[model samples]
Target: MKRRTTERKMTDKERKFLVELLACTPSKFKRWMEGAQNALVLWAASMLGMVLGWLILAWLIHLLVNLEVGMRSPYALGVVSLLAPVCGLYAICSSVQWVRNWPDPSEALRQDISGGKVLDETYNVIEAKRFKEPEHGGLIYFLRMDDDRVLVIYDHESIALEMEGENALSSSFEPRRELHIVRAPSTEYILEQEFSGEKLELSAPVDLTVPPDQWPEQESWCEIPWLELERRLGMPGF
Candidate 1:
């Protein structure tokens, strides 16, 4: 019996998509380093807090019990002081290992889109819109691809509101694509979509600088010109 292989060949468009996805790595990596630094700093602070808390606790116990030699407090403090650094070192090592094992931007993007039930063939980006949120200080790219597919890339601190009543928080790099979706916007814009005759509200109203175009057929679509979108995002036109 021959073994069946499940591997599917990538289309040329998919290859291009991968290239575009790879272009996001520098931004993704910078955010990843910043996160790792923040985590290490937080871990150090927590370890210090633990040591100080133990000292305070030990001192309080000593005061309450009225021990004579004061040996117990010193011993306990010594043990904690020794164990804290070990635990901190272990945490650092674990974090480093995890970082080493983390996936690159392209693979991560594939996972995100696949998890969202988007077919691999439609990974191509036909048109793209980019934006930046002043308050959040993050770059947002809206990719309008084939088959009514939309890929929303949230870089760094940018985020989006879910169709459900929940916050769709983004990590260092997130690629969100959904089927039968006409428009995808960041938290900064108010947009709506109708699927199966049911209307879906996406975001709340904001002071949008990009005015909506009058599309006689598809009024729901936020049709921002490609050149203008790039300009507004502070990126040179492709």
Candidate 2:
């Protein structure tokens, strides 16, 4: 049998850095999460688009009835009918695209959610128990650094889970409970840095004990689904 060898640790400064990182998180990530949750709303909107498109098409016909209604042909109706679904898909895609390119966290929330703070304080890694699922895709994080631009850790790989099928993302990326936030007026110069090295720019490396106990464990050893679990926990404004 093989035995474990060494444990990882972080310096005091890194620990403190993470404490500040969790503070400035954008609320847009939370909105993307809730949107994923109420997929029912997305689906409903798609269906509504279809119905609305059909109604508009019908109205176009009625207006045409006044102009050329007496000599109308099937070709015009067919052309309009064909265009309706394209418009419907466009509407759905347009509505959901911002779920990805949320320009600013505050802007996304202002239109979607009410009475939520743009940035909130937090102090517990174990508190991130919401984002623990296979179906959920990856999203953003608000890590803090000494530099001006924040870091963006991309986990674009795929995962095969025990209960579910293939997941395009697989990493244990729970944000350390340290963050600091800038106000809307000061957000003009905010930046993001992508991680290209071996490990994430965590304020401190994760504790081994907490992941197993608080996170959902699958048969696989390499993957850690953090955001999915954290989102579900409805991680409070902390």
TM-score for every candidate vs. truth?
0.35, 0.22
| Shift of residue 40 alpha carbon in model 1, Å | 3.3
- What is the C-alpha lDDT profile of model 1 across 1-238, one tens digit per residue? 1111222444455545544655765565675786578568757886777677766776777689866323354476667667677767766776676666664445555553353322212233344444544344344555564544444444433443333333323333323332232221111111222123222222222222333332111222335544344444343322
> Which residue pairs show collisions in model 1?
none
Candidate 1 lDDT trough over 10 residues, lowest sum: 183-192
Off by over 4 Å in 2: 1-31, 35-43, 46-50, 59-92, 103-238
lDDT of 1: 0.44
Instruction: For candidate 1, give the lDDT of residue 101.
Output: 63
